[model samples]
Target: MRSWCVLVPTAEGELVRRFLRDRGLLQKHLAIQREADRLVIPTVSRVEIGLPAEEREFDEAFAPIRSYRDVIRIPDRVRPLLPTSFDVIGDIAVLKIPDELAEWRDEIGRAILAWNTKLRVVAQDHGVAGEHRIRRIEVIAGEDRTTTVHVEFGLRYQVDVARAYFSPRLGTERMRVAERVRPGETVADPFAGVGPYAILIGRRRRPRRVIASDANPVAVEFLRANVAANRADLVDPREGDAREVLGEIRPVDRVILDLPHSAMDFLPEAVAALAPEGFVHVYGILEAADRTATTVEIQRIVEGEGRRLRHLLVRNVRSYSPTQHHVAFDLRVGRA
Candidate 1:
């Protein structure tokens, strides 16, 4: 049958498939056809996923419905409220069920599992909490365990979703920062969650060392395991408060601050650890209307610590809310 398909190279099949699957765009009923070095993946919706779609012939397979909405036994009036997509962390699916759909969570969970054969667990995320920034997840269907291994850019990371925070959404952003590291330069990631940024930078670039620190012991434990799993010898995992950890490892050539909500609060610690003309990659959640003032305040923060902002680049990473954005500030600072 002729269907909308994304022709992805064999090397990039897994990445693109996961991307399409997470967004509920992948058509699961059709058998993907292999042509030369590319795999043609069928998609249900026309989403701009940086790849062009073309009509291709796929073997029609007797498979279950591809979307949870298709199998969910809910009334037509409340069908619109069913979540269209969920986060897939490894084989685990993290979904947020609204109060209106709370009664049918089990049915929804089962439906979601049926949609994806690779998913071994389906968890309900009740928001992140506490100093460690852990998600309060409850297993709705499949396996009861929260531990899983997530892969990004061909590197493996052991992640306990309930005990630690790891956002697969930042995979591209992590690689972006990693590609910026200069050889022989020491990088410090103060808010390293499971060593994503630090390990990525260590593997991608020949940094002298990548110091990864986190207050959460579970996250740091996984970071250590991930560093070893990937054989990222340059990445050193440390368990402690970022301020204290940064103090112990002084004079870093670059620093990564990933705590979006409270990253600015630790700006002084990051500045204190930087070498002359050192770089700092800080993330924050900023109001769209206050972008100008926020940039000015960032400059002020850098200057307040007796360091002049030699160069600054602002990037809006993603949308946090209707009026707020997750932003990144790339800063190079020198002596005042």
Candidate 2:
């Protein structure tokens, strides 16, 4: 097994490992090592991962992944890598080849254009640079550890700008709110990361109010920047948890509950904070990957609110960290 250490931002250290570990290939091909606050993943290849079958047979196969490219041990430009991934949150993509092959990056990028008809690339000295075409790719810092710093070099596109607001990428949870939020209505996003739903809604429709909030200072900073960058006039951003902010804030016509990991836990707060007859977009990454499973979770929240899950809209936004259903539900609560 060939190994190349992968260094990532300290904040992303855990996620970096989980993202790769969730793939379950670690036992067979990869290994994660921790050095202080950084992460190191020994990838197994010098070649690219091929396209996985459209339909997976195994249960763990749906894990969120950067690409299906076979893990590479050695770094090489023009190494036929699957430099893009759509199924993961944030659409996270990686395309760092060794600086040794700066020329090869362009050559390989052109070849990729042949295989992936939709993608377009603008190569710099780095590997590849283009959002939506390729979300991110930079040299993994190779120092005491093999990890390289994430140095992005690309044409910042709409998606790149939009990334300022999304958690991973714009999941169904966010898209649901964008489609449903009406003009002249206030929408609250409790767990707004970089304001994807809020900013997107502001641009797409006439939301009288859209307040997006996040506890992570890093996320909050970006959220504010994104809202202002796009349409600062209508959308107001608050930095804090929904539980803390919504309790003291005014009412909203609609609410987007996107903290799927803890959304159910916050149902009480969401329902209590909701406006009379207001719309609530609740998201939950459930175990059962179906509408029935989603409804069950929705009912759990509306149990005592004198509200029933009147109408349930279900969508599989994307694979949630693999195998866990990344499910979104539009619940119309009826007065009990």
Candidate 3:
């Protein structure tokens, strides 16, 4: 049984693997082969593999596979009900399975494990709830574990998925906010869950100080662990309500409010904690068509705090639901 493959120089094997993984084109069942200093990588399709400058296809006689869909081995009856995608965090794969697929949860979990050898746990997201916005997940395959060490942007974060709210999807956003921090500036990440924002800022930007706080004690514990794991010497992890913590850390150069659902409720405290002409990054969940209303509400909140919004940059971070969006507003505020 021969299979088609993409040929490239052995030196470019890692690059090709990353490219395939990023594009979701990697063929997990076919093992990579070596021939005369070149690597042959099995791919899902032969058309437009998006080869880099250093890679090229090698001519070989092989039978082409039917489709990548066959690799998962889902029954035709249940195939349409399968989730299109899932999140891989460290050694765990978190899936969002619909109730219709409830009977095949275990099968779906096992298939996810087979899809990625690095994954040791397969969990299904039951949705986020409560004040901390923590997700409830059920382990359907492999080891029953919720704690995992995830690495992003050269920083390591230990997260207990059940106890803390952490999302790998926000990795880029974290770096984006960190890159905006100027050296020697004091930052306040009032809702710094697991220290993603605080640790990234302290490690990459080397901010003078980062006051990271969370209301959930379990999350705070992970935050402290992550701070030390990443050797973020400038980060100060605290366990308390964000409003109270911000009050104690008044006059910070930058303030990050990441409690998307309730961040607006703490606008006054964030404004009070900001230094003169400071920058504030606020994340909120809003209806897709309510961008104007969100802006007006934020502007009103700042004005009520006796601050004028000097500059405002609004961005849609991601889609929270079919009708809602995860939006971010970067506001540069000063005395009115």
Give the Cα lDDT of each candidate: 0.89, 0.55, 0.84
Put the candidates in lDDT order, highest first.
Answer: 1, 3, 2
Using TM-score as the measure, name the better of candidate 1 and candidate 3: 1
Report the lDDT of model 1 for residue 127: 95
Model 2 TM-score, 2 decimals: 0.54
Candidate 3: residue pairs that collide:
none
lDDT of 1: 0.89
By TM-score, the best candidate is 1
Q: Pairs clashing in candidate 1?
A: none
Best-to-worst ranking by TM-score: 1, 3, 2
- Candidate 1 local lDDT, 26-109, one digit each (tens): 998888878899888998956677776888778887765768777678888888898866789999999889999898899988
Quote the positional error of residue 229 for candidate 3 in Å. 1.5
Model 1 residue 139 lDDT score: 98
Q: Write the per-residue lDDT of candidate 2 for residues 31-138, one digit (tens) a residue.
A: 455568664454433223331112111112233333223332324545544344432122222244455655555454444344443334322223223321222433
Task: Give the backbone clash total of model 2.
Answer: 24
Name the runs in model 2 displaced over 4 angstroms: 1-168, 171-173, 289-294
* Candidate 1 off by > 4 Å: 1-66
Name the TM-score of candidate 3: 0.80
Global lDDT of model 2:
0.55
